[model samples]
Target chain A: MDERLLEILEDIQPEVDFETCTTLIDDHYLDSLSIISLVAELEEEFDITIPTVEIIPDNFNSAEKMWEMITRLSEED
Target chain B: MFSIVTYFSVEALLLLLVTALLYACLPQKLRRWVLLLASYIFFYSISGKLLAYLLFSTLSVHHIGLWLADVQNECAAQTKGLARDERKALNAVYQKKQRKIMGFACFIHIGLLVLLKYTPFFSENINTLLKLAGSSFKLQIPKYLIPIGISFYTLQAVAYLFDVYRKKIPADRNLMRLALFMSFFPQLMEGPICRYSDTAVALYDAPKMRYDNFVLGSQRILFGLMKKLVIADRLNLLIQNVYAEPNKYDGFIIALSAVGYTFQLYADFSGTMDLVIGAAQMFGITLPENFKRPFFSATISEFWKRWHITLGTWFKDYIFFPVSMSKPMKKLTTQARKKLGNHYGPLIAGAVSLFCVWICNGLWHGAGWNYIFFGMYHFALILGGNIAEPVVIKITQKLHINRASFPYRCIQIARTFILVCFGELFFRAEGLKSGIKMFCKIFTDFTFASLKSGSLFKCGMDRQDYIIIIVSAILLFVIGILQEKGIQIRNSIAKKNIAVQFAVYYALILFIIIFGAYGAGYVPLDPIYAGF
Candidate 1:
């Protein structure tokens, strides 16, 4: 799951080093448009529904946070 | 009723003074109530008997907020010990029910807005259709007494309800706090449409106004007045002339009106925001900023992001994000990715969402065809920019051109400014047909004769007015540059000696008094966005 998450991040926004980067939203490395596209990509890859309420910065601000959210949601399934 | 800007009347100033004194003297717990009282007074001044609209909006949203919160709480309690899948199903049912509650509330509030604001426009269009069809019956267009700031406050109320539904902030149970949020006087006329979570705490806290808050707020208000009176109102005469009788002049004058109206709009709207935010600061009630230096934007999308920052964000949160992430758009994104490939696929959803936003943007400005065209104009520009992004990058790379060079960046800004000005032309035109005709004439009747003929001065202003406008505009531009660099002019000045600070403050007042376009012959134009 972690490896696949890294691949998704790389495919969506290749310029950023998702491994170490922590300020995806604050630094505007991920804009609102990019966030939408990223969410769509994540939903397709993981086969899990990510609702709008879960789209806040805390969940997607960094690769680590993204992994945590995915792990929790995948656990629910 | 007080004319705040018409003459910088003493009555309004006295009201502000008295309100400040009342707020300062009141107990901390009651200070928020003082603000609520002041809001009612201000609303009553403009709306008189029509204050019911505001009250109605407040009550409806408040009730809806409580209902949504209660439903969520009940469902949570019921599902706490249930089986996992069963709980999920139960939660889904409650969620659907809550959505209905939120949706119906939004529909009612927004429906009232549409009825009051757009009925005349709809009636007029229907009458035109009847005439075209050779019908004897024609619709009687009924005019409405639209309460001041309905457009702004309605959006604020709607946002508050949504915030409650989303559990962004628990449904604010205090009716008065919610009412104050809906009718905060400073932003009632125009807004940076604030959110409940961001502003409610400070608003309800009602902290005593610090010295810095008062001084900074006054300075900001004065700065806004200077922009409005010294530049925007001064230029209003010539622009009004060109727009009122667009076909009478040549292309140069029409084009000049377009550019002038654009600056006038920026100065007027941003000035109002400065004054609004500044006034709020005086009460230690923070409001969001509505603009950045939009002219510096290199692309249309960038321009929207910078200009009217709050409105754009509101639309993004309420319209764009929801539409883009909707189930249907997800399917569209999937299909587009499979057929059109990754590079252009996601933007299909983005574009459709953007299209809805622009349509709303156009209609939100007013119930006018030209405004719709203005919205579509930007939509086309932004979508075009998006689609051409990679191609432009490839071209720049192939040419080995330095895209970040000063000259190259200037070219981008200038192109974007021109595109913005052309849209504002349509936005400020008398009607859609007038805008189209004026646009056509700009190319066909392009001639240097208007400049040489000395017909420019004949529009309204003399050479002296022109000189004042140019110098003031230069000053504003320099200040904008400093601000863009993140320099706080007020703070820097505050660091100066008392004498220097006093002199600077007095000088700003004197400059505004002498140069402001309000006197025996001149009537200072109202802030343009105030109507919206």
Candidate 2:
């Protein structure tokens, strides 16, 4: 777990524990636009292009999920 | 002008007969073409010569797009296998040619739009300026009639050029497909602002001629009619009266009228979108969704995101991002941050984007000063929120107050409502001066005691009318709530037993037929967004 990623999560959801908070979409923590904004921020931070089709909730619903998605994208690049 | 008599009594029957005939006679691929033709004829029946302008604009853009694509392909080929200097020279020529073509296309398209929509405003302003200079100049306000779908098609055409430029989609080769994209009759008058990419597939696909599509489309159209006639038009009478003379009303009454206009505009616009999209669906084309439980939005930004989704997206993509991300704007932001510190950069950027969007939005509605003020009013609210967001968050943190607490959320919602009402005051006002007068009257002559005196209903609506408005508004709100919770009303109904489904359908039809503000002494009001 990257400390910078933790810091970003804290900025978005100050009260929630980044490690514990899962199922972001199911919990309704972020709507579609919010998710897009987050993805854009993550792409800028990590220097990776998140494919448009990979932006679905299934791949972005949790910290672990997002990390996995980003890792995959980075690896593909 | 042809004095075409509109017989609402025969409209449904005629539509049904035509729909049936098209379904029975036309082959799969040809039905959509027939529908497209029918749509043009329908628009021509209302707009006459203006329809010819629409056709010309559509055909011109279609041909230009195809030509531009060829030029782009040629440029790509020429750039390949060239030395650096030669490549640069070739690229410059290509760029210059592309720019000329695009500039010419945009000039012609937007020229027609301005001539048709803004001539009166331009003439009046020029005359006023001339008079101020003591010239006493009199200019004839050109009597150019605007086509019914000029604004919509213009936007679509511009979007096509943009799409081609960005290489989001290939320039459409088929003239008929491009024509259908522009003149799809359902969205011709008022739009969800159909995009080339969003609707191209459904528009070009050979029509399936399925019974299911027809039934579903009919049901959707019925739902749209119910929302528009039964709820929106009925509420319009009350809204118009209070807004017409805001001085005679108290703050509460004026506020109520503002709220009423909100509902009326939403229902009228969304209902029309539904009808248009549904009609397109009948021809096996699915137009973009325009509304999605907008009132449930917790923030002003969220409300905009949900309300008029298509138009908002269009503005965001075509106007806001471009202006915000422009080189000059970026340079200014960088300089400002270095001089004024990091805090001011976001604020300045936001203000620039907000101003651009609002000015364009206001002018897009019409040339009236009221519309301009309406645009600025919202611009101020949205910009103010963006500026104050960090300050508010800091204050809450310092006070140890929970930002997402229920009480805080309630306060935010209440403030948003107030801000929205104030903006709507300008939107519904007759002119800029009247908007100011009515706004001042809100505080000067406000009396809450008089609100309960039953004088509010006297504003062109009787007791029964008020009752109907309130009831229908409640119904509208209830349905909106259901939708906000992600309950797909149509799909839910489809999932029900056949008997129950039929019963609900019959009930909806009966409600619309009996309670609708159409037929028998009712003058049908044009869909409000058609003016834009």
Candidate 3:
């Protein structure tokens, strides 16, 4: 799951080091348009819905945060 | 109707002092009531009978919140012990019901705002259309005594409703808690637009006044006064004259005034926020910061994020994300990504959402073609920038120009500022036609004849006034640079010796007293955002 998520992140923004950098949204690495692409990619890959409420900076700021949210959401589903 | 004119007025200061005193003397539990009553009094003084509008909004929001809470409770009870599939199905049914209720709530709340605020603008446009159609019939345009800060508070109320519906926040059962949040006197006029989860409980708690907070808050308030009195009001003398009659001036004068108007607006609106947030801080409630050195922004999109930040976030959360993430838009995003690749793919859905957000943003400021033009102007710039990004990057790479270099970043900032100033020119013009004429004159009759002849200072601002404005702007720019570097001026000051702190305060007060625009020949721009 982590590898796939990193692959998607790299595919969207090739310049960003998705492993070490955590301020993706905060630093403008992942803007609204990027997030749109990301959410669609994540849902398709993981088969879990990402609601608008969960699209906050904390969830997508890092790969770990995104993984945690995906795992928690999938369990809830 | 009362002596309290604006937050900067002596009368308003007296009201704040008296309220602070009362709040301090009151029991911890009763402190919230004092705040609530003071908020109502403040509203009543400004809007008079229009206070009823605020009361109605508060009560309606309170009731709707409870209703939504009740619906949630019923759903929880019904879904108990159900299997996963059944529970999901039941939740969907309940969600539909909640959506219907949310729709009605918005109708009542947003409906009242539209009817009150936009009726005249809408009717006038309709009448023009009718006249064009060769019809004699006309709609009667009615004037409304719009409650001061209705625009600000209405957004707050709707945000509350949305938060409750999303279950991000449990709907408040306490009326006074919600009321205090909605009508919190400090942020009532021009807001940083506090969220329920962030502010409601803080207002209810009404923490005891601390000495550090008092000093820090007072310092902030004084800084706000410096911005408003020394800069915003002073610039008003030039901006008002130029905007009121753009054709009377050349493009140079018009352009200068546009930049002046932009500064005036920043100082005016952000100054008000400083006062608002500072006042709230004195009571130990930390409202969200609104302005974040917007002039330093590298793009129009970044400018929006930095300036009037709360409003930007509100639209992002409530409008942009929702529209973009809706089922159809989601599907569009998925398909587009495959076809257009990562960058341009989701842009199709994003553009649609951006359009909706901008249109609402334009109308939200006021009902005018110029305001709408301002919105579309920005929309075009942002979308154009996004579309051109790859090409620009490739071109820069080919030219061996490092985008991260200081010179490059400075160029970006400068370009963004010019674009923003142009938008403000349209925003501040008397009408769309006048705005166009003024813009055209900049190119058609471009000359520095006024400066050569020294007539530039003759219109509203004299030589001395110009000198003072330049010095004050330099001061503001230095301060902005420090703030951008993450230096908290107030905290730094607080850590200084008592004498230094006092000197800083006294210097600020003296500056305002010496150069503040008031008394005669100058009308301080009426709280700019208040009209919106």
Candidate 4:
């Protein structure tokens, strides 16, 4: 819902486009290593430390999914 | 000769039965010792006097490591809370002691390795030098039979010393456990190259066997057998014939043989890794994964990460990173960037690491010139990739091409295959000159007509055999694709009903029995990585 989050999603869409990338897992766009790198980048940019378990495929599937997960993690903190 | 008989078919069966019995009946503390004894027996059976050499090298390293650890502990205690001058003096003493110990360990292990593996090469060079010096003496290089797994164990021993030096893990105090870890029968001959920190705990504190571990490990063994007997051995025929006479074949045929060798190497090496790791798993021990669908890797660096992972990681940790991160290389890169630009820093570092990794890889494979060129070939490709990364990104941006798109990925995959094929051509070549000749002939005499005329089949394979090879390769690729897509094949099988499980097991065993390239008339091919 936030414009800043939307901008981040747009930036990642090309590399992590699950809708168009059938070669990847159905829900998650990035592989294990890619997800780790993405999380590091996001933490630096968004100023939030994503919990280790929250980095799994189920929660970080799409832009909307990642936003929901991040919002919850931040709220919990 | 007696040892040879112990390794024969019936003996192997008996050994397996005995091992199973021991696993069932032996007390927890005694099982490891029994396994260690059995491992030595297996080695002695094959290696004879060479077994003594292995034992000597293992024991020497074990004692030296223990001694070094004690010295380091003493130095650390003396230096604690000391003034800067006193601390510096203590640290210098510690460094000197560490260096002396490490140097002796390295000399003994590397000296043994060079003597066993490179004596012939060294002897020839020495003779040539003698002749140049006008010596009247004519010396012949004596043939020495290398002990089985000498190279593997030597590398493991060296890694153990390095680990101790770094204080990553304390030097293992138990000599038997150290010996067992180094010479564990199943992995000793051809290793995934076990590290002290990674496999030490498992070898020392083996957990009680669970039903799940047994079932999964069994499945892994079956898969390994399928890959080895059904695919690699079959491909060996074609590779050997083509490489034996590279002059006879055109580039296309040579290229095909190279591709065949790649598949054969992967199947043979990874298959054995599965068998070794799986065997360890049966004792509820988890070994480091050796392969992760290597061919699916999009980049050369990625391929190294996925293929023979332990070996790659070893070289990276012990060789490449150290060389690349050395003060001299770092200063050179920093100076170059300040003078020239940041673009060249990565380029220089990449080149250094690639060169180190490749040369080591080639030498690790063998002392052969072909192996060296194989290493150089990959070094060039990986270095080229690193250099072109920025340019590629720039070009794609300018062209408005989505680089991560499926079509783009396909192109990268195809390019990777071509790169791999070229490397294998050199790797499978009989010698360096043959590799060059075969590579040159590929461009000059390439023709599609050879395929039509059945020249491909002329390489000691029947039409039926070729058909089987193709089918099995397709099956392998299918399984690889499924795995790449994150399908857990073993878990999927586990979730299936019991009838299906039994059916799958039976099918695998039956296929191996009938279609496997072993038994009557078939020469048993040694595991490919065993020589290394």
Q: Which is the leading candidate under DockQ?
A: 3
Q: Write the per-residue lDDT of candidate 2 for residues B34-144, one digit (tens) a residue.
A: 767766776777688777888898889888888789998999897888775687678679867887988898889988898888999989999999999999669988877
Better model by DockQ, 1 or 4?
1
Per-residue alpha-carbon lDDT of model 3 for B2-103, expressed as tens digits? 645688888778878989999989898999999998899999988898999999999999999989999999999999988878987898899899999999
Between candidates 1 and 4, the lDDT winner: 1
**CAPRI category for model 1:** acceptable
Off by over 4 Å in 3: A2-7, A15-21, B1-3
Q: Report the C-alpha lDDT of model 4 over B1-532, residue by residue, as the tens digit.
A: 3444322245653665577568657787887877788788878877777789888988888898898899889987888888866776677788788988888888888888887787786687688889999997766886778898887888889888887886766888898889888888777777778888777777766566667877888788888888888888877777877899888778888888888888888888888887777777777777889899888777887888898898887887677655655546555654554464444543575477668888878887888878888898888887787678779999999999998899998888878877888888887778889888988888888898877898777776778888888998889889999999999998788678999998999999998888888776666566667767
TM-score of each: 0.96, 0.85, 0.98, 0.84
- DockQ scores of all models, one per candidate: 0.45, 0.10, 0.70, 0.04
Cα RMSD, each candidate: 2.0, 5.0, 1.4, 7.8
- Tell me the tens digit of each residue's lDDT in model 1 across B481-525: 998999989999888998999999999999998999987777567
Each model's C-alpha lDDT? Answer: 0.85, 0.74, 0.91, 0.75
CAPRI-style class, candidate 3: medium
| Interface RMSD, candidates in the order listed | 2.5, 8.1, 1.3, 11.9
DockQ of 3: 0.70
Choose 1 or 3, whichever is better by TM-score.
3
**What are the runs in model 2 whose C-alpha is more than 4 Å off?**
A1-77, B1-13, B82-93, B337-343
Cα error of candidate 1 at position B511, Å = 1.2
- Please report how far candidate 2 places residue A2 from its true position, in Å: 15
| Candidate 2 local Cα displacement, residue B503, angstroms | 1.2
